[model samples]
Target: MNERLRFVDPTALMHLSRGLTFNPLRSAEVLDDVLAAFDEKNGYVSDVQAWVRGGGLQNGPCPTLPSGRIVADVTETMNAERKVLHAAAILKLEREAGIAPGVFLSMVSPTLDVGMRVELPMRALLKGNLPLEGTYTVYLHVLMTSDGRDLVYYGITKRGWSLRFQEHTRSAISRESHRLFARTLRDLTAARARELHGVLDERPKLRGLITTICATGLCHGEALDVEEAMVEKYSLASKHANGLNMIPGGAAGLRAAQRFKGTH
Candidate 1:
């Protein structure tokens, strides 16, 4: 198990990633034994198990997550490509995933349609171990245009999305966080030569800013897992060159979650 990260075997970690569904309990048990062996407390011992189960903190340009739209605001359109599926249609998806009815959340928007037609099912069953329901939320901070080329920031929170958005908002508005999300906001604010509040109010009206909910009902571990996957999928890391995230999702999000919710 310890060999998973060994530099000697580069393929070990890749093998882990390629395989879907990790046994968190198994990973946790192994890590516990390893940690006990060296009495290591502040290192990977504390986080590896969680990483194996879940994954990032993205206060992304989303860190500047301004007030944005939700399901209720969706403008039903005749276009079939962007429509959010109704719960009745989602019933089969929910039951197949073994989640309680209505727990698999799906959001809609013409800007960047997020209904079951797209990634709704992808997040839920990333790994066979993923639960259909839990507390934490895995979300995307999106900025898109009519071209639909959107830039995104990903983050997870047990806190209501509003409260967490405020945390990023406060940090970015003050220019305290240098993370990509904050930078994106500051850059936009600077570009318009306008006050932050005014810019926040303007972006959505122009249909350029969007806050997306990927999925809810994730337990701490599952949320982290999905967040990491989102970061990777969206290319949020700097190397991806298109994402607004400076840090990969999971560890940071997991650490924050541990602080707020404890390692239960």
Candidate 2:
């Protein structure tokens, strides 16, 4: 089994934008093992197996299947494209969770028409596994027009979309404050940013004018209106340039608005 494991070369640990690379035979073997476990222990359905059977090639286009359902018809060709589909699923779950909408979330102005279209499907493609942890990170690019409509490009991370914010647990505000009080607040804030983006995309009046602010170093101590959980998350983002900064402080409206305009 260990030999087979060695034969099952995992995907390379590298930045995603460079390109997609994989070991087909090894990947095939790993897929087989995963499918076997899903069936034997996870109680995954036959249809799900069918999706992974092809190594995910055949499963993605079937729009009829629900998002959370495991799939089997995995094809190397399909693996790359399925992120968007899965991301939409996670977005649906987020909406269902009924988390409070961030105060800063709002729509773009109708007269502006200044932004581009951000599709839900493409955003899903960015979802994949993370380097530090085996969790997923869903990446999304949102477009806000001056006219108060939004375009969002969303997807799972390249490694695996399941890697992000997987550890989030609901607790009393006091308890939540204590858990993240001393910890880095970047992840918590980024999660809030994503959540706000998800909601702003739907609300036409707000038009996708949502903003996220991330500050680190000396700035972390400064007071802000953002939730405590988000403060932690944003702090981390600033540290890595992986954080969100839509707030007026870190990056002013002219800069961020330009980025939205693609002029930056």
Query: Over all chains combined, what TM-score does candidate 2 have?
Result: 0.21
* Model 1 lDDT, residue 199, Cα: 43
TM-score of each: 0.42, 0.21
Residue 83, model 1: lDDT of 36
Give model 2 RMSD, 1 decimal.
Answer: 18.5
For model 2, the stretches where C-alpha displacement exceeds 4 angstroms are 1-21, 45-137, 140-264
lDDT, each prediction: 0.44, 0.29
Candidate closest to the true structure, highest TM-score: 1
lDDT of 1 by residue, 38-100 (tens): 225334222323332444122211111012210111122234574322221212332234321
Q: Hey, what RMSD does candidate 1 come out at? A: 19.0
Please give the lDDT score at residue 234 for candidate 2.
40
